[model samples]
Target chain A: MAKLTMTVNGRTLSADAEGRTLLSDFLRGGLGLTGTHVGCDTSQCGACVVHVDGQAVKSCSMLAHEAAGSTITTIEGMANADGSLSTLQQAFQDHHGLQCGFCTPGMVMSAAALLAENPKPTEAEVRHHLEGNICRCTGYHNIVKAVLAASGQDVSGVGIAAE
Target chain B: MYAFDFVKPGTLAEASEALSHDGALPLAGGQTLIAAMKQRLNAPEKLVSLTGIPELKGVCAGDGGVTIGAATTHAAVAAQAAAYYPALAALAGQIGDPAVRNRGTIGGSLANNDPAACYPSAVLASGATIVTNTREIAADDFFQGMFTTALHDGEIITSVKFPVPQKAAYAKFQQPASRFALTGVFVAKFADGVRVAVTGASESGVFRWTEAEAALTANFSAAALDGLSVPADGMIGDLHGTPEYRAHLVKVMTKRAVVAAG
Candidate 1:
């Protein structure tokens, strides 16, 4: 085992991770920050997306030791300091963005990264940016709605009229 | 994934020394290597992390061409190369996805030389130079075949220098699932001549289409490729497409690239 040290959600965390331990496993199993999901072990799925040094990357595709001395931000780090939902999280809740919620953490993280880079993304950009993250619920209608809304865009009448 | 020794070398000299060890592999971005390790496809006894070497990570544009550090991530290339080479930047932007782009490096992509990868097409078409620790190799001489490069063991790719072309563009038909090219074509027009490279279609690997290049050299337009079609015998035929289909796509994508270049 190798000793690893990194900043996660603003705290310096250390653990003994094997050479092969993935960043996803370290965050979820070793650190107890289970919000980062690993839907597909392959690199195709972005369900384990997180910010490493402010850039969004798939955790499952990176080794935990490779992330040493880096700053990592996960779904658990997105809440407001007062322990309330952040604006983006609130947007998801207000728009009913998730159903089964298995892919929410990953979706939120990807969207937040997009917003961080491109603050006012178009609906088309949101869909394009989400190509890596897969969702089996909501058909991504409200998810797109939630992202646009979080960008402060008027997402009224954006999705199908099933409501 | 099997347990292995991990070492982050702070300098290129140290990294090169570490890579000289038997069963030691250079780790960059870890986008492809880590995934291969997870599937037990590769089991290097030691992983020499090159991320700590600051000299291997940026872009420098000169009058002759643009030189990009081998370790520069695709995302960085997309954002920085836009001003100098829009077509190259666009190609980088469309690779895999946002997350994959964040972790995948140009060097790793070139070294892995995945058959369907988009970089080889650009590098070959642009006549780029692949610089290593010991020597520099031309793009035409660098890529050997699918997942193979001319790089010797223990020699690390330091940077790639691309000559500024007067006009260039890359067009690709994604495989949909992996987002890798089902068929991709890159067309570049330099002062001397036109070069065309095709990826994801050939069974032997990425190759320059002499017919397309000769035609484009005379006309430099999509209409130049009207009667040209790549032979189907050597084209790749898999679940994504048939040999004939890929052959047909070669013409279509090349024409699209020419039009886009203008």
Candidate 2:
């Protein structure tokens, strides 16, 4: 067993788990942050995406021990300190970016991270960036719109405006 | 996942020593190994985590070449290689998603040597050197076969040395599901010679397409490969594509890569 202490969703938490414990498992099982879902056991699916040390990563493919001392932000932690939806989350909701919603949390987290880095991304940029996050429903058109909208742009008028 | 003892070693020597033990696996980025372990495909008795080894992470440029630490994430490579090795930068950028690229390491990818992986082709085409704890292996001899490498048990890859090429490019047809190369080709022109490496096709893992290389060497033009044919023998056949389709893709991607390289 290994002892892991990390700041998740702005909370400093620690736990002891088997060496094989995945970061996704640690979040859901240990910290009760079930917002990070596991769609596929393989790392191919981005449903388990989260931010570690401010970089987005697939939590399912990461070991909890590997994440020790890191700062992680899950979908549940993306909201404001007062518990309000982030711009991306609101855009996703406004644009109908999700259906069935299994992949929403991961998608939202990834989009949030992308916007954090490149606030104004083109439609192609948004599509390219979100390639890792697969959605079985809502064929990505709305997701792109959501990301564009979240960037505070008018999507309809200017061919998925950037910035 | 099967229960295992995990040891986060702080040095390469310590990690190597731990790997010398029975059923010890060196954990770099854990993007590949950890996922395999979760599926019960791998159950090492001991995992020597290399994350604590500060030395095994970063990109260093010197002596007309760049040395990338084994634990350096793909994102780092993508974001930084643009100024050093543009082809490598583009290839790294095209790997999986932002998350996988952020955590997956070059050492982990090469060590795993998945047939459909993208890095092998780039490494081979660039004629990079694989630096392990024991010795340095040339790219030509490092990849043995599918899911196989020249790494001996307990051998840890410390870093890779890539001589920046005059011009290079990687063109790949990615598997939509996994984002791995369905068929990928990397072409590079070095001071020594032009090297062409193809991945995601051969059953023997990554291998040089000598004919294509010869053609490109003679004339580095897309039209130079107008009638070239990549043999279908000893190629992989899976649901994503057939051997013939892969053979066709090899030529197509190689031509595209050569064009991009020019």
Identify the candidate with maximal TM-score. 1
lDDT of 1 by residue, B2-55 (tens): 889998889999999999989999999888888888888999999998878999
Candidate 2: tens digits of C-alpha lDDT, residues B1-262 = 8999888888888888889988998887887888788779999999998878889998888999989999888999998778888899899889888888888899999999999899999899988999998899999999999999999988999999999998899999999878899999999987667889999999999999988888887888889888889878888999998999999999999889988987
> For residue A48, what is the lDDT in candidate 1?
93
| Clash pairs detected, candidate 1 | none
Error of 1 at A77 (Å): 0.7
lDDT per model vs. reference: 0.92, 0.89
Per-prediction share of native contacts kept: 0.86, 0.90
Clashes of 1: 0
lDDT per residue, candidate 1, A1-163, as tens digits?
Answer: 8788999999999988988889999999889999999998898768899999998999999888889999999999999999999999999899999989888988999999999999999999999999998998889888888999999998776754354
lDDT of 2 by residue, A10-118 (tens): 8899988888888999999988989999998687768999999999988988888888888999999888777888888888888888889999988998898899899
Error of 1 at A151 (Å): 0.7
DockQ for model 1 equals 0.86
TM-score of candidate 1 to 2 decimals: 0.99
Question: Residue B172 of candidate 2: its Cα lDDT?
Answer: 94
